[model samples]
Each structure stands twice: as structure tokens, then as C-alpha cells.
Target chain A: MKDQKIVIIDYDAGNIQSVKYALERLGITPIVSKEEEVIRNADKVIFPGVGEAAWAMNSLRKNGLDLLIPQLTQPVLGICLGMQLMCESSEESNTKGLGIFPLEVKRFTNERKVPHMGWNQLEKLNGALFKGVVAMEFAYFVHSYYVPVSEDTLASCNYILDFSASLQKNNFYACQFHPEKSGAVGVQILKNFINL
Target chain B: MLSKRIIPCLDVKDGRTVKGVNFVDLRDAGDAVELAAYYAEQGADELVFLDITATHEKRKTLVELVQKVAKELNIPFTVGGGISTPEDVGVLLNAGADKVSINSSAVRNPNLISELASRFGSQCVVVAVDARFAAGKWEVYLNGGRLATGIDLFDWILEAERLGAGEILFTSMNHDGTKNGFANETLAKLSEMVNIPIIASGGAGNREHFADTFIEGKADAALAASVFHFKEIEIPSLKNYLKSKNIPVRI
Candidate 1:
């Protein structure tokens, strides 16, 4: 078969360029689109975001993508806030999410800084993203809120607390870290997603 | 584990890769794309391209060069120099840069940092601060270390972080091109003070210098021009030396 058409949903939440760049590096042409047809026709979807939770969700709601995303029958990959929005609800905007996974997005306990930035290790690679990656591989992150690990948790990271780094449920896959900026390991993860 | 990065800083002038000693005495390096691919295969973690001559006549050529590099290399890369507007950053990023570093322009218009950070998020915005000791304190320099901005080094780093800079690339003017070692003391101070990752530049002479930067300065990454270009310290060898010291590197 021809390579699966990867579509990166763009709500202007930031980090789309890096996600697109990363996918391109993997020899996959990912379309950054808000158009329904493009996303519905894509074999896989990557939703990448970097911003306040509520505002991002609100933007998704405004474009009615909040409804369009969960309906994705093909494999869907969400990055950072995109992953957060895949959960039940968020403290970010007091907004409800797609509820694809049994998880909740909450703000980090104030003990640590708001944005837990920089490189951190990811463990428990139980899904496609870690197909061949070594355990404890470091990935770059920059976010204030995180999704608590649930039954579908695929990967997790630690800062103030342990949280889901990557999640998978049936056709949905998401990561809280920016794999696009995580160097070679990140590219490998993207390659895995393409192969899936 | 992540693979170690070997980055070649391409200083572009008139659309050609240029090298200089201590910020002067310019000489031509190889083609940007060819050189970037060479470093990538040599185990470079990432690549940085600084448009030293980002002037009016030579503007489009810089973007064209970045496009070429993006087409050839597979690793992460950052582009800096003469980025005055968010549109400029967006253009370079869209053309194929993973991150965009801003220096003099950020100092002149601090709002640019917050604006870009808000629109693109902090992770993509890198604040490159060039510092030189003057009048008993480190002062930030602009225009490729040609003009003094009178901003305190530590204070500027703090401000940049608060304003949403994802990372700080601290280059020591006194140590640049000297082949001595990084200014560990200054890096240690900034590393302790700032929360964002710091890339230590200037004065990286040998393998020990790499260890010292991480062990003492606590920098997340170390960047050097001459040591890497002149073949004095190979990237993999340097990573091996650091690994021997029990420093965590992607090898």
C-alpha cells in the first residue's frame, strides 16, 4: 500500500510546524488542516498543540473539531495539549474534552514550576511509539498540565509527579512531549507512528 | 536513549558558509547543505545556522539556504540572526527550522519574545545572549557582539526566561574562538538561576572542556565552533569522554 496519509490537525495552538517538520523528516507528507475532509480521509491524524488548555480547547470547539477528532476511525496521534484534550476534562479551561481515554488533565501542583520544561526520561513504553526505543529514553517537554496515567497509559514521565507521556487506546495515540524536538529518538517514534 | 548531537554552526554571508576567528578574519566553509549532512552523519545531535549577513540584499538567499539544509538533514536544526519579527521566525521555521534563535532583536523589542512565545509557544523561541565582562560586570552585547546593551547578563537571562524563552544560548565573548574552555563559573551561575535549558558556547577547547561544562556549569548542552570545525574535538569522541566521566549523553 502507499504510505498512510498522515494529517496533522491545526487549530493554531502552536508546535504544528515542528510536528509537520518531524513527520516530513520521516518521509511522510503530513497535511496541516482544519478541513473536515482532509482529516476524515487521513489514515492517521496527529494533533499538535502548545498553549493554555482552555483556550486551545475553546479554539477546537469554535471550529467544531472537538467533535470531529474523537470520531476519527483511523489512528490519531495527539501531542502535548492535543493529548491533554483527549482526556475527560481539564483544569486549563474548565472545559470538557473528547473523553477518548479515561483520564483527567490537571495543573501541576504548585510545588514545582508551572511549565515543567526541558528533557525528561520516559518509561513503560507499552505501545507503538516505543516500538524499538530503549527504556528511559529522554524526550523534550514544555507544558503546565498533564494527563494522569490510566488503564490505556503507554508511556509516562516524572517531574513533580509521574504522568502519562504517551497514551494509546484502539485508534487513538497521543504524547505529552514534543517528539519533534527530542532528536533521533523522537524521529524514530514518528517513524513508528507512520509504520503503524 | 537519545543519540548524541554534533552540530555545525553555519555562519552565512552572501548565501555562503563563512568561518571567522574570534568573530573576525572571515573564511569560507563548505556548502551549507553538504556540510550539514556531513555533521549529521558524524553523529551531530542538531545543527545551528546563523545568518551573519542577514542584510537586505542577501535576505532571500538565507531562507533558500535553510530550505536546502532542511531537505538534506534528518536531525533537529535551529536558525538564528536578524530575526526581527514573528513573521521572520515563522518563515524560517516553515522553511524547515525546528527552532528560531533571536538575539539583538529581542533586546530591542522585548515584546517580540512574549508575542512569539504566545503564538508559537516558548519551546520554539531561543534567546541567544552574547555576554562580555565590562566595568566589573557581564553586559549583554548586540549586533553579533559589536554593541553593548548595558543589560546585566544574569538579569537578562532571568528576564528572558520569564518572558517565555524556551532556552538560553549563552556565548562568552571573552572565551569565543580562544580554544581554551567554557566559562564554567558564569555558566554555573546562570544554570543555577534559570529553569530553562542552557547551551554553553565559546571556549570549548578539548574533551575535558565538555565534561567541565556539564559537571561544573550544569549546562544541558555545550556548543563550540572552532573545536568542532578544525577537527580538534570530534563529536563522538567528546561524547565518549563525557560518558566516561559518568555524564549522561545520548550515544
Candidate 2:
């Protein structure tokens, strides 16, 4: 079979380079753009971001790509803020997400620390991203908001709470952790996404 | 649980990696990209590139080298040496560096840490300080350990954290390249003084030293050079040993 083309939705999000660089390592030169036709024509899509969820969603809506995203039939992946934005709503910056997954993104309570940085174990798996990986394998995470664990959750990680590490519904897959920074386990996850 | 990280420090001079003992006796090692890739595959959580050659004529060349490494390596890469202002942070970030380590400049202008952190976020700013056991205390050093800044190491570390540094890369000049062990007492003290992750550098000769740095020194990460470069301790084996010692590490 011919290699599948993955399109990374780029609306000036900060993590574009890291995602693109990771994809490139897997022999996939992801086309980073907001062009409707390119995204619609691609075999797969990757929504990557690192910033305030509201601002990022606004950027996506301003470019008219936010509306086009839910319509994609191909497997769509979201990272960090991308994952949070795929939910029903976000407490971070009072953002409304795509609602692909029946989940809510909420800010970390002050009882612990904000911006739960560093590596954490990802338990529970129900998505292609965890295919062929051991349970509770460590993944690099750097986020302050999390999607509360729900029936749609594909994996769970705990920092301040046991929340969804990744969520999947239909052809959509999203991870709160940064696969680009998670080393080999992250590389395998990206590879699984490409295969999917 | 995440594994404690083992990082290999590369001193780049004029776009090439060079190693020395006690910050002198500089000798050629290998290309930065090749070594970084090797270390990454060997299970290094990250790699730190210190532009030991940040002299006037070598600054631009080192930046170019960083871009090259950033392009080829998949692991998180940090660059340090002569970063002074927020603009320098921008230049390195734009060149694809994952993090920028600030030392002398941070001590000179404490606000530079906040400026860089505010602009790029704390995760991007790593405050580094080289210290030596002087006058019954650790003193911060600058200019590759040639000059002393007279800043108390503990006070400077706390100040960096307050200024929004995400991580602190503390190197002990007295133990650097000595291959005896880390300044465990000093590291333990500093580790207690801050909440941000601390990367212990200098004086790593074997696998046990890495565990000691993490366990006894209470460092979040351990960094070395000669041992890794000379094949004294491979990254994977050291991590396995650390794992056996009940220290969390990515294997």
C-alpha cells in the first residue's frame, strides 16, 4: 500500500515544529497547514498545539478549520491543547471544544501544582496510540488542564487526579501527553497513528 | 512512573564537541549530531549541549550546530554557554532547541530569567550555575570556571526559580571531571531549597555515581560526559542499574 499522508492542522500553535519533527522521523513529512482542501484530502490528520485552549480554538475557528475538523472522516489525532479542545468544553480560558468526545477539560486544582510537567505513566488503553505498548509506560506530559476520565477515555494518567491521558471516539484520537517528547514510546505511538 | 533521566553533556567548541578535565585540556570527541543520536538510542532521556565555545568568533557557528542537532535528534535537547538576553533565547528557540540554559547572564541580569520565561514559558528556560566549594560554601562561577561571580549558589538557585526557571542545571566545579562522585552534600542542600527539577552535572565516573546523584544527591536528573563518551557506562545499563536501586528511570 502507498504511504498515507498525515496533515497537521497548523493555526500558529506553538508545538507545530515538535509534531512535524516527530512525524518526519517516522518518514512522514506532515503538511502543516489550514488549507481546507489539503486537510480534506489527506488520509489522516493531526491537531497539535501548546498554549491556552481558548486562544488556540479561536485561531482554529478564525481560520475556519475548527468547523472542518469534526467533519474529517479520517483518523484525527490531537495533542495537549488539541486533546482538550476535542472535548465538550475546557475550563482553561473558558474554551468550548469540538465535542467529539463526551468529556470536559478542567484546570488543575490548586491543591497540587499547575502545569503538571515531566513524565507520567499512562494506564488503561483502548486506542491505536497504545497499540503494542506496555501498560503504564511513561509518557512526557506538560499541561495544566485535563479531560476528566469518562467512557470515551482510551488511557488514564494521574498528576492531580486520575484523568484521561487519551480519549478516542470513532476515528478521533487525542492525547494530553506530548508524544514528541516521550522518546521511544512516543515514537511508537506516532508510528501507530501513521499505521492507522 | 517516569524514569529518572540520564543526560550526556556535550561541550561544543566552534560547532564541534570537545571535552576536558576541570574545564581545561580541551580535546576533540565527535560530531554533536552523531553523539546525540547514539545517546538517544542508548536510552538517554535528553541531551545537553553546552557551547563551551561561545567566544565572539564562535557564537554563530555554535548556533548553527544547535540547529543541525535539533534537526537530526528526536530527544529533548538543551543548549547553554553564552545566552545573555531574551533575544538570544528567541534565536535558540527558533533554531529548534527544546530548552535554553542560562548561567552567567542570569546572574548578571536576574530579570532575564523572568523575561525569557514570560515570553517562552518556564518549561523553555533552564537556569544553570557552575559552583565550587569556596570559603565554606558553594560559589557560582562564570566564563567556563575562570571567573567567580561571588553569588551564593543556594541564593542564586532560589532567585532563578522565583524568576520562573523551570529547571536548574547545577554543576560542581570542584567535582567536575574528577570522576569521584557528585557534590552530594551540596546537591542535597540545593535540592531541598527549590521545587523545580534539578539536573546534577559533573563528576560521574560509573553507573553507581548516577544512582548516587539521584538517591543521595536528590537530583531529578544526572548528567555526565567522559564516562558516556569514553564508553565507561552505557546509558541503558546505567538506567537499568538505577531501576534496580529503586530509582524511577525510563528504560
Candidate 3:
């Protein structure tokens, strides 16, 4: 397992360092790269991000990384804005995403909260991410926009409404929460992603 | 639903955790990294490391300590004190701090808040307001509560929030070190005025103080120093108390 290569796609988004540190804590030195070949040849890839949707999308498009991302055959994991970028489109800046999942990222409304920041419980867990993790385990989240629960939703959390906490479709997996910031349970999720 | 947060704040000076009463009478508490890992294991939702070191050389040492602690724990950690610029914030964030807190510098240059938020995102920026009631008004203080700014407490918090501060750490100087309880009335008012999360800091002597801060003060989180530093209140037991009071706390 130590010999397996893990690449963290550097789209110049936020929280990339924390994700790298989290992986390092698990004894895997992940390569932070934007180069096409390095990302393409990795055993596993983590597409982690934080920040405004439009700015991030523009950066990805500028580097032509947007075109390269969808073509990766390896297991890819997206976090927060990275997950939103994987969708069909987002209300934030009205930008289009990778369309890996037929989902829409919308700004949270209905007067509940804007960012929906803090730790919240996950329910209806499915897929390899929650293989040994229990139902209703808490994970740290900080985001204003969220991907609504859809067919690709693997885990759901209710903030203003039931939203996708974790999403999965084929080899691509994503989480709206910052699992790197979450405690021990988060380590398990990262471990599962590595194993997958 | 988001659970209420219990944050254990460690005052780090010269690479060691220090306990100071009302920002005076400093005494060594323990090692920062060890104390932080203990708090994380004790059910502390998050940790705040206030680098009280005044010199540039010691500040660098604190940054090194942050890297060491970040490697030892998994919970979110916030670093504050002596962080004046976006580059300073960048240093700590790169050192593995989840957030950087600014107090005096943000007051001196209000634009710093927006600059940091734009560069690192608002989620990584925390604006701490150390306030004290004087002459029938709550006024802001700076330089570790040695000087008072004429800015109104509520007004400054609202302004900081508008300027892209993700959260506010409101410490009531009048209630600090008293152990009577948090300034619930003032905290509740501040909570009503701001849309972002407010962390109630300063006076937290027992478990009930935590509950009062959450239920009455309406704060999103409670931060304390002496109580936890002296072991008067264990984080796990305090969390259990909060849970029993029907307050949602991570355990």
C-alpha cells in the first residue's frame, strides 16, 4: 500500500495543504500536482477544493485541467468546491461543472443559514466510504453552496434540508464536508478512499 | 443540525502553554502539542492556540509548534495572536492551522479582514473582539486588553462580519476571570446582531456556564482557558453536561 501513488490535483483551489497533511498522517506521501501525466498515472486522486465556485472553475479551465479531470479512469475524490465542480452546474457564478454527475450545486437558502458551518451527522450511508463507519457519525463542514441529494448521493445530512454529504458514481467520490478537519472518523473515510 | 462547539484555548508563549488570569500572572500550563492532543482526545470539538509571544523570533517558534501539533491531531485548530498580515496568516495556515485569528491588526486596518478573506476564504479568518463594559457601553479593547478602542462592540462585530469575517470570538472583559458566568445578556445581543457564528470566550468556570452561554447567550461555541488549564472542568464531562442539558455538543 505504501508503494501505491496518490496524487492531489492542484487546481489552485483552497484546503489542498490540509488534505495533503491528512494523507501524510495516514503514512502516504501524496503528490500535489497540476501536470497532466502525474495526475493521469496516479493510483488514486483527490480533487480537494475550497473557495468561490466561479474563480475555481475559471482557474481549472485556464489550465485545461477541467478537460483532463473527467477523463481520469482512476478513483477520484472531490471535497467541498471540488465536489461542486464535478456537478453539471452551480448557482454560484452560474458556472458549468465537469458533469460527471447529473447534479446541480445551489446556494443554501430558505433562511436556515448561509455557510452551514460546523460538525453534522451523516445518514443513509452507502458504498465503500462508510464500509465500517457507523450511521450518524459527525463530520466537519464549511460551505455556502451544496449539491442537493440525488441518485449519486451516497450519504445525506440535513442542514437547511437533506443534502448530499457524500456523493458517489462509478469511480468518482466526493464529500461536501472537510473530512480532513474532522477527527478520527474522518481518518477512516480517507483510509477507505485509499483502499478503494 | 450543527452541534454546538467546545473549544479549548491554549495560550502559547515561547512554545509552552501558559495560563494567565485576565491576561496577567502568566504561568506555564504544559506543552502545546501534548495539551492539544489531550484536548482532542477528551472530546474537544476544536482547539485555539493563541501565540502570546511578542518577538518575531518567538513567533517563528510558535509557527513551528503549530506544525508539530497539526501532525498530532485531527480536529480543527485555530491560531491567533501576533497575526497582522495576510502573509502572516498564510504562514500559520501553511503550518497546518485551520484558521488564523486577528484582533488588534484588524481594528487598526479594517481592510485586512477583506484582504485575508479574499486570499484564504472567510472560513479561515476569525475576527476576535475583546470587549469590556465601561460607562454604560461595551467598548472594544486591544493589545491584550491594555488599551481600549472607542469602537462600539456590536458595531465593530457587524462591520467585521460585513467585511467577510467567517466567525467572531467575543470575549467579555468584564466577565473574564470572574467565574460568575459569561456575559450572557451581551453575548445574546451580539449573537442577534451577527449572521456568522459567535464563540463565547473568557469566563467559563463550570459546566453550567457552558450551557448558559449556549442556551442564553446563543453562542455557536464556547472557549475557555483557566478552567480547562487547571482541570477544574474536563472537556468530556463538560460535553456530557451540555448533552444532558439538551444542548447539541460533539462527544
Estimate, for each residue in A90-171, the C-alpha lDDT of model 1 and write its tens digit.
8876878888887779888866444675567888888767888888877777787888877888988887888889999998
Top-down DockQ ranking: 3, 2, 1
Q: Which candidate number would show the highest TM-score if scored against the true structure?
A: 3
Computed on C-alphas against the true complex, the DockQ of each candidate is 0.27, 0.42, 0.62
Worst 10 residues of 1 chain B by lDDT: B20-29
Q: What is the TM-score of chain A in candidate 1?
A: 0.95
State the TM-score, rounded to 2 decimals, of chain A in model 3: 0.98
Off by over 4 Å in 3: B20-29
Best candidate according to DockQ:
3
Clashing pairs in 2: B3-B248, B3-B249, B3-B250, B4-B248, B4-B249
Tell how far residue A127 is off in model 2, in angstroms. Answer: 2.5
Model 2: per-residue Cα lDDT at residue B186: 84
lDDT of 2 at A11: 90
Kindly indicate the candidate among 1 and 2 with the higher DockQ.
Answer: 2
* Residue B202's lDDT in candidate 2: 89
Please give, for residues A1-196, the per-residue lDDT of candidate 3 as tens digits.
7778999998877867788889989999999999999999999999988888888999899888999999989999999889999999999889999999899899888475457888899899999998888988899999888889899999999998999999999899999988898898899999999999
Q: What is the TM-score of each candidate against the true structure?
A: 0.88, 0.88, 0.96
Point out the higher-scoring one by TM-score: 1 or 3.
3
- Candidate 2, residue B243: CA error in Å? 1.7
Tens-digit lDDT track of model 1 for B1-251: 32223355767776677774232222324567776776676767677888888467777898888777776666668899889998898788777776899999999998899998877777778899999986789999998889988899998999999899988999999998787888899998998887777888988888998888888887777777777667777787877887789886756
Q: What is the lDDT of residue B216 in candidate 1?
A: 89
